[model samples]
Target: MRAAVFDRFGPPEVLHVVHVPDPRPGPGEVRVRVLAAGVQPFDVAVRAGEMPWAKIQFPQTLGQEYAGLIDAVGEGVDDFVPGDPVLGSTMLNGAAELLCVAAENVVRKPAALDFPTAAALVAASQTASGSLLELGVGEGDVLLMHAAAGSVGTVATQLARRAGATVIGTASLRNHDRLRRQGAIPVTYGQDLIQDVRDLGLQPTAALDAAGGEAIAQSVELGIPLDRIGTIVDDKAAADHGTRVVRAGRDPKRLAAVIDLAARGEVVIPVQPFPLDEIVEAHRTVESRHSDGKVVLLIAS
Candidate 1:
């Protein structure tokens, strides 16, 4: 099987497509013929060695979320069968034609969604859901979300709105209109964020920090109880300040909830899928940090 392999990571240019041995599922695992692999900030971080835990056995295949068809199951796995479509999240080994993961990690894909979109929904959406859920966000809560146009931000806004929370989202001016369309009150990133929220007459009852700038950290520091704040990035800093980390690949129950939202059409993943040969370009596109939505890799059958 051919996989994109990198020895020492630096830039996207370091990635190369190489033919090596095909991986098989061990006990309690399943081998998936990957149809689409979702690339997130984490994927880019792994490629650049920014994420400390993304390192595993190298030469590494760096991807965390995928949607594919089951090809084979390990001895103890009975939850899935060959030909079934599944979507899942993992910490590593996802950027390839096939993946071997615990059967528990793979959830049956919604019949209504396509593979690439399914792949895009899990990691980002789940992280969003977990943070909101942990903060106990519900009806009548006014929520503040930093980086409101990001993949997780988009989903978080939608989900919070669906739950009847009034959402104020912070993004660049160019993204404010779309954020409003998604049911959020938009504030430009560099604007007086707190004063802007106050201008809307919405006192924020909770906040999710997806952007991780000093501004966000200072906002939490000024008043928002450290316990009420959660960040999907900057885990170390968040911890240092008593803010929570919305750790991805750490909660399976949250993942199931996210999958349910996608099935219900409460979450949307807008993206384009590139094949393995173009994997280098895919990584580059994500690294550029200008993608409005996800950029995924479609591992050819």
Candidate 2:
């Protein structure tokens, strides 16, 4: 199998394409012939050695979300067989032609989406869905999403709105119209964030920080209760202030909700797709944060 492998963590240049041994499924696992792998800030963090909560082993193949065909099933796996289309995340080894994931983690691919789009959905949508579930968003609730134009932000905004909650989202002035089109009240990041929500006559009952910047910290300072704020970023200060950290597997129900929402077209996978050989370029694009969509690596092609 050909994979993007790196023995050391550093810049994107550290990532290299090389021929590696094909992975075999473990008990209750399935080996997927990957068509695409989703690139995210988490992947960048693994590359840059910025993640302190979790450590990646050396000679790592970095990727979290993937879409592909199940080429083989391990012992005790009965829900799927070879040639089944699936999309999901793995503990590691996602940036490769073959990956082994727990059979329970894989979901059947939605008929309406292709491999690349399905690959893009797992990370951003699952994160957003799980966080919103932790916050308990509902009808008449005012949900504030930081960084509304980005991939996770866009999906979060739409899911919250679809739940009958009023959504207020923040982005740069350039992305305001895009956020508005997704049914969120757009507020440009700055001091005006609070004012913009005020203008809408909506008091934020819950807030989630997908942006993970100083603005998120400042916004949390204003009136929302600490327990009502959740952050996906590495902001320990969010916890210090009594907010929740949206950690691994906080709610399995939320993961199921994201999958169902994707199947129903109420959620979207906003991505900029690049071929696997262009892994370096994809890394740079995601590192720059200039693109408004999730950067995905196409593996099969």
Q: List the residue pairs that clash in candidate 2.
A: none
* Candidate 2: worst-modelled 10 consecutive residues by lDDT: 247-256
lDDT of 2 at 18: 93
Cα RMSD of all models vs. native, in order, equals 2.0, 2.0
Minimum summed lDDT over a 10-residue window in model 1 is located at 213-222
Best by lDDT: 2
Q: After aligning candidate 1 to the native by TM-score, how far in Å is the CA of 154 from where it should be?
A: 1.4
**CA deviation > 4 Å runs, candidate 2:** 248-253
lDDT for 33 (candidate 2): 96
Q: Please, what are the lDDT tens digits per residue for candidate 1 over residues 134-175?
A: 888899988888888888898899989999999889888888
lDDT of 2 by residue, 50-160 (tens): 876666777888898889999999999999999998888786688999999889878888677788878887777777877788888878888888888887788889988
